[model samples]
Target chain A: MSSFEAGAAGFVLGAACGAAGAAALALANRRRLGRFLSFAAHEINTPLTAVNMTILNFISGALGPVEKTQEPWLKMLREQAERLALIVGDLRDFIHLRLRDGLSMHSESVDLTPVLEAAVESVSWGFSQAGVAVRTRVDAGLPKVLADADRLQRVFVDILYHCRKFRDSGGIDVAAEAGLDGRIRVAFAYAGVKSSARESALALDLYYPARVRKDQLLTATGLGLGVLRLFLREQGGDLSVSNQPDGRSVITADLSAAGGGR
Target chain B: MAAKILIVDDEPAIAENLQAILSAKGYETSCAFDGSEAVAKARHEKPDLILLDVMLPKMDGFDVCRLLKSDPHGAKLKILMTTGLDRMGDVEKAFQCGASDYLIKPFGSVKLLQKVEKLLSGA
Candidate 1:
């Protein structure tokens, strides 16, 4: 064989080896990053938990007597702590979903009543602080739906949080009923802040567009909607948003009923 | 007598804060800083409920739970697993290892109290 051809073959082999090494290094770094994120989440949550427990002690008068003026400050502290905790949680979940195939869920027959109530409870404080009222109605004896209770609760929490951001003073009505299509539908209706069609579409995107006005921003982190949508889709459910004619908007989530819509 | 609860957490501040909260609610409480200590204390004290933390210095909370749960005397102990890990896999593992309930860290006081009360009453 000619020396020129031999040199060319050697160069090709060298390049292949270099590319393989780079890919290996990247995979290792990715794994390292996943581990680091998991560690960071646990570490942050531990201290945050302690702080929350302490705040509760002070507010409940378990530690001592809280003066009238101190009460409002305590309330504010509690709210801020809750907000920080949620951000940390969302950050962890966002990274987890990106790194993993998807979240693992154990679907079972879950009563919608408690799940809706818990979701409302989780975000009710924020709603009240924003001068918004959330009224949840689960039809009496509502059929159980097939879902992961925890994930379902979070889906509602994200929607409620989203509603709180869009509507400052108006009320939000959350109603769940068995859809005729053999699925359970939960609707969140509220007067929404006006936005462009593009902005509305981008709201559920991984990150809300920076071009949107400050007051019209959907979320500070813009992680909830995207994560919640992925979670719903994973559970054989779907989420949709619609802007009504009267400047009001509606977000609906549909889930299959347990026992094949029994 | 008020129900006794064993709070197991490596973080001293967390353990102390939980003690104060439960104590104020008229429940007797004790603290264990690691998984081995948690197992020993739960065995010796036989508390009505154990607020077990998953991460520990010696043996992790899941092992401690599995160990105690294997003993006939400890089978009835209501172990409420607490963790800073938000993974649903950990939650499912906690239940698989016989945790009575699971509470993610940063949970509010009312939630803690409600779960403790419900577990104790149901016992």
Candidate 2:
């Protein structure tokens, strides 16, 4: 081989090696930052949790709610604690979503019915306590899907929490069935209050605020449905939302079924 | 007799705060500042519950849990891991090692007590 050809070949190889090393270092740094953010988020929760709990114990045990002097402090403390928790939670979710972006879903043969039921059960107590009704009707014979059970459940639970924000009419209906496109489709239809139409489109975006034209502006602790949609799409599915003719917001999610367990 | 708890953590503030909260709730509590110390107390004191911390000197929380679970009398010993680690794998590992429950660090007093209450009640 000619001397010029050999040198050119070495130059190309050296450049490629340098680029690879730089990429590796960048990835390591990204991972380190993600870890640090997660740690910080957890630390934030700790003190907030302590203060809130102490106040509650004091109100319930040490000092009764009848103590007028402490009532305002307790109320204010609770409100602030809740907001802190929301901020920490949103930050945590955003970090996790970013860290997990582009990663393939961990595949397992997950039954759609049980996962849906569990998600609803996890949050139904709070919903009922707050006078919000949730009715779940999953098709009895629906096939299982190859997906991550935890993320899939979070997708629905997060949606339900979102429903809690925009649902002023007091109820949400959940149903799932096989879609025509060889997928399992889950629908969440809930009564409307004052949510803007833009929300139906933009609600999936990270930290998207659901605002009204004149009066009530509602925001939730959940990061957003966009990440959940991303999770679904990565695992052979899609998510979308629309406003019904009857003035209700209906969210539809489709997941490719596994035909049967692997 | 009130149920006894061994609070295992390296952080003094977290360990002491938890001790105060659980003690106020009418339970007898003790503290160990690391994983090896936690194991030593679990064997020595044989407390009804041990609040194990994940990150510790000598050994990590998972190893401590494994040791406790494998101890002849540790079968009935209820372990509740309290840590700042929030990964799903850690939770699964805790339960796999026979943890009665897992509480994330920086949990509020009421939440902590609730888990403690549930574990003790089950005991």
Tell me the whole-model lDDT of each prediction, alpha carbons only. 0.80, 0.75
The residue-by-residue lDDT of candidate 1 on A18-57, one tens digit each, is 9999998887788678768867877887788788878878
- For candidate 2, write residues A96-213 as lDDT tens digits: 6675343434657788888888778766656776788899998878888877776677678778877877786869999898866667889999886545766556666644544434
Task: For model 1, name the residue pairs that clash.
Answer: none
Q: What share of the true interface contacts does each candidate keep?
A: 0.62, 0.10
- Kindly report the docking quality category of candidate 1: medium
Candidate 2 scores an iRMS of 5.0
lDDT of 2 at B108: 65
Q: Report how far residue B38 has shifted in candidate 1, in Å.
A: 3.3
The CAPRI quality class of candidate 2 comes to acceptable
Query: Evaluated with DockQ, which candidate comes out highest?
Result: 1
